[model samples]
Target: MATKTADADLKTASVLAFERKLDPSDALFSAGRWDERDDPARWAPVPVREKSVRGTISNRLKAKDQDPAKLDAQIDKPNLQTVDVAALPADADTLKVAFTLRVLQGAGSPSACNNAAYQAKLRQTVEGYVKAHGFIELARRYAHNLANGRWLWRNRTGAEEVEVRVQHLVQGAPATTWRFDALKLSLRHFDAPGEMTETLDEVAQLIARGLSGESHVLLGVSAFVRVGAGQEVFPSQELILDRDSTKKSKTLYTVADVAGMHSQKLGNALRTIDTWHPEAATLGPIAVEPYGSVTTLGKACRQPKEKQDFYNLLDGWLLKDRVPAPEQQHFVMATLIRGGVFGDGE
Candidate 1:
């Protein structure tokens, strides 16, 4: 006869298997309510990161006055271009999920035991839970979208290449929604060696929490796990440059100059409404007089510190303005080069 503890372990394992196969389409076991299935189009798969660039250099000399021995040396600069990360997009998100398990024991529990049946049961239960809950469909959608979209992978030779894969949700957005900005799933077996029942219980609890519209549970989990792993995850809002500091300047060319220049160039490149804005109308062609002179904007502006200030200013501009779409942000960046914002030897 099986011991009570053994029976409990087997039962827990069975529950875990069931949880694994639970799909979103599955009738809610707790409430016994079945919701209509959602079509794939209801959600958009996250974008993946897969952009790259390549560079090449060449040089030559010119013969002077038809003298073969007398030649003038000319150094050719290297050319840089964005390499197609083979149909990869430029941005994406990532999601992670985790599970943890522990075992329960009574006073009469066996001291020594190995349970293969329990493990198999746990796997089956978890699989069932996941499937019945529509998780498989969700994962499949992400994989399909990512594979059909774009991805960039770096080759062993250091050349960046593009791969087709779905982006993982890394951060942002509340948990519980079908579309997660980011997710983390973890599974751990605790108590007895190789005992996975507790971990599966934890997973079930998380799924239930999610189904209940409890966003904070996942957020707490993310924070706890990240801290335990010694990782730092800051909010996106913090990444934006501070508004006050970004507005001030101590150089001849103000932060406004850099921002204005960036905006102007971006406007031209993206063909942003030819109808001039009051800001652009007032500042006409702040020309690069010498076509490459660092001193065009004066000595104070040429300092490395001031150069950094220009970047900060541009960042501020990007955060505030809606003149150019986010997709065209790179065009604004190009203005830095055109304005000789980095001075010579950049």
Candidate 2:
């Protein structure tokens, strides 16, 4: 991968970057409350507010006609969980991707919280965790999402491209600005390899060090996107709707929508280090991740007319009794996630 790193000579608008906080709507970190035992390394599927992954995942259960009460409890549990592997078929694609999760909230005194000491402690702890291993599983899913065109529709709503920026706050120097591609920071999978390339490891290590809270360091992420002709994109949060049926168009929707779009543009910001609660995962070379590693999910674009049927068909396959072929299951789930639930019903 191509890479570049500069000293304090760079000056850019990233000095006022905004953090793209994590959306806890996924199978991992969805529980409303945080459990101290929950590790950033391993996570389980839990019932989320979103309809796509809500409630019990019947397709992954091993026992036929499993107890409904037990299923509900599993969804409610706030600790690490072992999924019923027997319920699902084995997958052949075992690939792992690496990403560095570092803290961007330390160089400057954190003003987000009232307790200065607590904020500093929190930043150091997070920096330590990100440097130790970073997140692999989440990185893979994010790569999967990125590769699949998950945010394309909304992103395409505006003809304009977006620019993402990272602010590097030194103790007493001007902040530096950079992009993921420039830093060679991207979600890459290596199926045919003995170890990560020396260059990639070097970049990851450098990022980890920069993210370290050794000295007063402040980090923030921001973006710039302009629309072209024949299309329009507005901010998501700018529009106020009393109900879901309010008029809708090519508007951007919410800051989350913009952040999501920026992540897509940045290439490496998929579930980046600034997420709310710690999350990440890793898979070995022999066994593919059980949930949805191999699939046609990212292969084809969803036709406008078939949006409703997309979820309907998936629900029938995964949430119901019709177990599909192993590869088919992966593709279905992958496509389901890649084609985000937003704007589908409309």
Among all candidates shown, the one with the greatest lDDT: 2
Off by over 4 Å in 2: 1-153, 156-164, 171-174, 179-207, 210-212, 215-217, 222-230, 237-269, 272-346
TM-score of every model versus the real structure: 0.16, 0.27
Q: Candidate 1, 330: how far from true, in Å?
A: 40
Off by over 4 Å in 1: 1-54, 57-76, 80-197, 213-218, 221-346
- For residues 130-184, write the lDDT of model 2, one tens digit per residue: 4543433233444333332223334323323333334444664336644322112
Candidate lDDT values, in order:
0.23, 0.30
lDDT of 1 by residue, 114-204 (tens): 4455444423433343344523222222122122111110111121221211111225433332221111111110111224334333433
Model number with the top TM-score:
2
Candidate 1, position 266, lDDT: 17
